[model samples]
Target: MITLIRVDDRLIHGQCIVRVLADFKIEKIVIVDDFTASNPVLKNVFLLATPPQAKSVIFSVEETKPNLLQFIENNENVLLLMRSPTVALELFKSHPQLKMELNIGPISYRPDTIKVTSYTYLSTEEIEAVNEIAERRVRVYFNQTIDQKIIEWNEVKNLLRSG
Candidate 1:
């Protein structure tokens, strides 16, 4: 019973804690980020940011599949968060049985990355991965918050190709 699968570089932040929690009755926050999960200090920071009523845990990308199986078995209402489109692509590849939509938000500008929109950014590799995900019949859209306008990948696909 996963409610949402979100990709935000800033995994758990003030805005996300406020916006996502308000829109979805998220019972559990599962963060899948290798670095964040392995770092004691950063891991505690993300966990501490979780709402009191909602349970939270962090796992490496390699560990999410088995955990997701249990979450499904228990019918847990989950909000799965991860860092990048690459991670999302990996998840889709690893768990091909999953039928989930992807919502992307706030990938900060970095070297070799193209600014797709105000909040969304992508490298050439990332853009290709995104297209690959969409080709797999997954609905992939970009929205900063639940209330904001959702920009479908198709809307930007051609624009990116011309450039």
Candidate 2:
């Protein structure tokens, strides 16, 4: 079963490995990102970052689509991590059965993106994509680590609409 569906641009990093993993006792990490899945160097980097206590599998969005259900059903205490809202949105769009609430973490500042929170930023497209995901009945929240306060999706939605 999926313990958490996290969106963190840095993918698997210290914060994730130290705080989130131990907090959830996540036995498996299913990284769903195209860039990391295809590039051996990037994939190796993520693999190295992951703690040996937990196993991780990297898969591209397209590759993960068909196997998503299996990944969730077969694994116990799984944490699915993606680099962006778009990636999580894709999964929800293709596999609506992924009805679990999504946790939004660090989304590093980028050229076209606006800061929604200290660690969370979104471009116009990303904001809309997030809104659509919520409309699909999925809950999304911003939380950098297990200790931080979770900023709800509606709060983000309102912030985007106002500014």
Candidate 3:
């Protein structure tokens, strides 16, 4: 089963290996990002960054639909990682049966983005995407690491005054 479905900008990094891996007791990290999956170097980099405790695999958006259930069946503990809410929204919309929570983590500041949290910055499009995901009954929350308290999307939406 999917232990945690996380939207982390930096897919597999120091924070992930140091905190998330242990905190979540993740056994397999399924990265659902088209760009990173298509790029060999970036895929290898993320794979290398993944700690020995958890195995990491990359898959594109389309690939997820057919393979996600299979991935979950095979892995004891799964951490579904996506780079953005866009991808997570796609997965949530496509795979409705797979009930899971979405944890937004460390989305970097971008040109057309507003700061949602210190670690999370989102563009107008991303904000809407997340709202849509929450509307579908998927509980979404924001936090950099497990050590911090989670901020629910409801609070975030109220803060944004746009949800």
Top candidate (TM-score): 2
TM-score of model 1 vs. true structure? 0.95
Clashes by residue pair, model 3: none
TM-scores of all models? Answer: 0.95, 0.95, 0.95
Model 2 residue runs over 4 Å out of place are none
Candidate 1 residue pairs that clash: none
Each model's lDDT comes to: 0.86, 0.87, 0.88
lDDT of 3: 0.88
**Candidate 1 lDDT score relative to the true structure:** 0.86
- What does candidate 1's lDDT look like per residue over 1-163, in tens digits? 7788888999888778888866888889889999998899999888888888788989998888777777655676788889888888998888876656999888988899998988888999999989999999999999887778999998988999898
Count the clashes in each prediction.
0, 0, 0
Model 2 residue 63 CA deviation in Å: 0.8
Instruction: Quote model 3's TM-score.
Output: 0.95
Instruction: Give residue 26's error in model 3 in angstroms.
Output: 0.7
Looking at candidate 3, what is the lDDT of residue 30?
Answer: 92
lDDT of model 3 at position 148: 90
Clash count, candidate 3: 0
lDDT of 2 by residue, 123-149 (tens): 888888898889988888888886789
